[model samples]
Target: MSEHVDVLIVGAGLSGIGAACQLRAGHPGRSVAVLEARDVSGGTWDLFRYPGVRSDSDMFTFGYRWRPWPSETALADGPLILDYLRTVAEERGVDRLIRYRHRVVSAAWDSATARWSVVVDHDGVESTITCDLLWGCTGYYDYERGHRPEFPGEESFAGQVVHPQFWPEDLDHTGLDVVVIGSGATAVTLVPALAEKARHVTMLQRTPTYIIPQPDRDPLAVALRRLPERVRYPVVRWANVLKLVANYQLAQRFPAQARKLVRRLAEKSLPSDTSYDEHFQPPYDPWDQRLCVVPDGDLFRALREGGASVVTDSIETFTPGGIRTTSGRELAADLVITATGLELKLFGGIEITVDGEPLVASETMAYKGLMLSGVPNFVFTIGYTNASWTLKADLVGDYVVRLLDFMDARGLRTVVPVREDAVGERPFMDLQSGYIQRAVAWLPRQGDRAPWQLKQNYFVDVRTIRRGEIDDDVLAFT
Candidate 1:
């Protein structure tokens, strides 16, 4: 049997749930169905179960605008966040609209009918859903698995191997010496948390990241749980935004000051004799790549308390017993946790096509970081790579709802992009950051224009997305 809906949402993550909530509220008579690939709907939060799994950004701006978080802590762990998402879905009636364990395998658009034919796998059976509009919120994280570095003789090493995404539920680390690979956020987070249970936790990193330790608490959030939303929401949100902007400004305009402070912290955190010049300093400027934040000097405190530590050396290979470092040290480990970072998957592995022809992501330009050129009725919410992801995500959501309302009022059934000849010919992707550069080949590019280019500035995004006219000729109305 087949089902039909006014709108079909893929992946019931933050974006999907947010889209559903707004769609239902705006058009009360419309039927919207969200299909989640996994049985659970927390997306990234539900998938990553490593110890001390938390957000780098404060939950104040990271949380939904409609429902403010009561926690004072800026850094929220996985369980709390997962619980928050579940609560939002349930409270907003989004849970009822979700079809759990339904994975969308393929979606083919019929240009003649102007509707999407979506194929989903449900409980070992394939079913189809037809919808006038399709919303994708699959998120950037690949659910298939995370990126694991291939170590020489890793399979032969007898130690239990684990990744943060697929952490063993029953694996007991008590009294075991553990070695975690990589120096990204995941690696830094695991060191502090695992040190509590493991005999020793060694973090191996080839290059050091710009690390800044900050107070993870939010004072406004602490005072707001007792107050009503009308009185508290704006104050807290604005305050967080101010701080993010100020810090970002410092990193952008006065890079030296930020670098000096980071250097000072590293010097104070590490041993006096330890080479602050060598092990602590990064090759690039601060914030050139993503700067990792540690709470309460957790990693430093763990190192002090446990006497277990950080080693800056490339992994030479895996020995029969453990890992062999480039420093010619063989580190013995009872368990190995590969905290090596994630692999980027564009649009959650969905193959996008327009008007019965395939759409090449690299060929298209990014439209205000939310929409892409040549893609119609599609608004993707990707937040600032440097700042809090949710701050921009919230704005993007508001803009999308407003755009939809504008279309419906005018009795428009379709919205398609008008490809400007000049914008399409320009080179789109150019960022020096390793993460962005690594996946540049796969990511959708952008051109130099009002709607085609991506401006990282929040103020610019606000002017463009929120206040912009909906009836512009570039965005064709049908």
Candidate 2:
């Protein structure tokens, strides 16, 4: 006898837990099982144990819409975020539904039976589980490792090289000089954090990223703390949502003005000796890439205090003492941290086949950025790149729930999003981030029209996904 599940969800991260919770709340009778590739429940949070791994987005919008966490801290540490995810899962009984260390290998859908044969690697032993509907929540990164580019002559450095993804818990940087390469969110976050204990820290970057500062405490959360949970959560959440939308819109509309504002802020925070043009200015316009957020100007404060410094140049090679720049400048350091970026991997690298035919992701179109066209009884999530990940995740969860409800009401066994009209293709992600650009070719493409393309704006998605009709011309029901 073969064990079969009707709704098998892959991953136990925020999106997975949110998906299960939505099913529990909206359709209590539905059976859902969550499969986590790792032993722990919190995916990214559990994996990242670095000194200052924290969320760049505010917790108000980052947290789930169905259940908001108690903490309202604007930018929360990794541990806190992990704890919140675990607590939410436990409180809603989603934890009981998760089977850890059961990594999905492949899923093949058979139209005749309307069931999917899912191959999973459980504790190194291969096992197959069948499902009527498959939901992918593994997120868009490889869990085992991150993107680590080999620097020329790195073996000659004779110093410790650490990647933020697999941060060693026992590694200590206290009283040691550290050189962190890359200017993304990880580098910005780690510079000040390592500076607090390390003798000195240098942020080495090929190019500059827009770094801005925001308050540690959320103004709305503090001001609305006196209000009831029902009133406060929604008020604060929506307010922040609108605020983010407006800011993103403004940046997109007037990129030059936005760039000038960022430059002015950086100039004021940084010391007079630091050249804003040389060390802080980026080649791209604002919103072309994500703006790194530093809480309370910690990064700039560290630089001003001489605890850390920024070096802007391409790498020539690694020297015995430290990194050698293309300008022939050598940065001496005892430790080297490569905060490069994530290795983008979709659906936990699971192979998908429809009726014995292999489904190539690049050949398909993303339907609402959630479901793939021509794939039946299947849905996947790719969160908002500009805003909080959960904002789009919550909307996707709702869409899946509503989709299930529609199928059940019509006595349908399968649903597939099929596009007939011709539309221009675009990359899955809008951001020009290095990680996305590197993996965009393999990822699925999005159409230029509605129901086929993602608006990315939270308000537009809420209307289309949350309350929109499910029985549209695009979705074929059987």
Candidate 3:
């Protein structure tokens, strides 16, 4: 059986939930349905169950703009984030519209009918659904399995090895020597949390990453909580946004000065004898890759208290009980954790076809960072890399609603971006991170100019996506 709807939203995560709420409020007459591959509604929050799992970005800006976060704490844990997501879905009646375990396999658009034929795999059964428009909110990573680099002698290691993505519940690390691989946010977080239970925790990294301590509780947020929700939310939200923007601009304009300031702050957190430049200082400038956040200086405190340590070197091979580095030094461990990184996946690895022709992402240029060139009646929500993800996500939801309203008013059946001239092409993301570099070939390209290039700045995106004109010459409506 084939079910039909006015709009079909993929994924039931933060972006999807926000999009559903916006659609319901703006166009109540439009019938909508959400397809979630997982059984739970909290996408990333529900998937990651590792120790000390929390948001790297502050909650005030990371949270939805429409709703004020009830808690005053800026950095939140996984459970609290999941609870907030559930609350939003239930309160807005969006939960009832979601179909769990329905993974979208492929979507084909027909210009003749102006509808999309979507195939979904529900458990072991195959089903079909048709919709006038398709909105993709699946995050930019592979959820089924995280990226795992192959070690030369991984099988020779007698100790228990675990990846944070597939952490076992029954596994115990208490009183065990643990070595966590990588120096990203997950590695920094796990080192501090595991130090509490383990005999010792060692964070092994091939290269250094920028780390900064953030206040776990915001004093201004706490003070503003006493006022009404309407007055407190906007004030706190803009304050955090401006602070982030100013810091980013400073880093770009004065890289050397910004680097020195970050190093000084990191040194203050570490012990007097420890060398901050040897391990904490990254080779790349600040904002090249995302800056790691440690709340209340937990990671530094662990190092100072002799609970955890760090080693910067490449791994040669895994030995019987530990790993041997390229420097020929061996670190013994009873447990090895790979917190390496994520594997980028576009549109939940779903295939897309338009009028019987396959659509290659790399060949298409992004249109306003929301829609793709020559792709009709389709939109994908991707957030900024430098700022809170939800900040751009909220704007995307609002812009989608506006686009739909415009189409209805004009009695248009299809819309797509048509490039009129040749524009210089660049990679989708400008970051030098490994994950992005590995997936560059599989991702889409961006133009050098506006409306075609991705403006990662949230303030610039707000002006263009929020108040910009929808009826441009580049956009063709039929």
Q: lDDT per residue, candidate 3, 17-121, as tens digits?
A: 989998998899999999999998988999999999999989999889998888888889889998999999999999999999999999999999999999999
Q: Write the residue-wise lDDT of candidate 2 on 1-478 in tens digits.
A: 5688779999999889998888888888878899998989988889888899999999989988878758768999999999999999999899999999998889999999999999889999988899888999988999888999998999998889999998888999999999999999999999999999999999999999999888888988999898898889989899889988988999999999999999888789998788889898999988899999999889999999999999999899999899999999989989999999999998989999999999999999999999998899999877889999999999998998888888888899999988766888988888999999999999998999888887789999999999999988888888
Off by over 4 Å in 2: none
lDDT tens per residue, model 1, 261-358:
88887667765555666766888777777878888778877777754688899988887678999889989898998887777777778766677788
Query: How do these models rank on lDDT, best leading?
Result: 3, 2, 1
Clashes of 3: 0
Q: Rate the local accuracy (lDDT) of all candidates.
A: 0.78, 0.91, 0.91
User: What's each prediction's TM-score?
Assistant: 0.94, 0.98, 0.98
Candidate 3 C-alpha error for residue 134, in Å: 0.4
Task: Name the weakest run of 10 consecutive residues (lDDT summed) in model 3.
Answer: 417-426
After TM-score superposition, what is the CA distance of residue 190 in candidate 3 from its true location, in Å? 0.8
Could you tell me the TM-score of candidate 3? Answer: 0.98
Which portions of model 1 miss their true places by more than 4 Å? 223-229, 271-274, 424-435
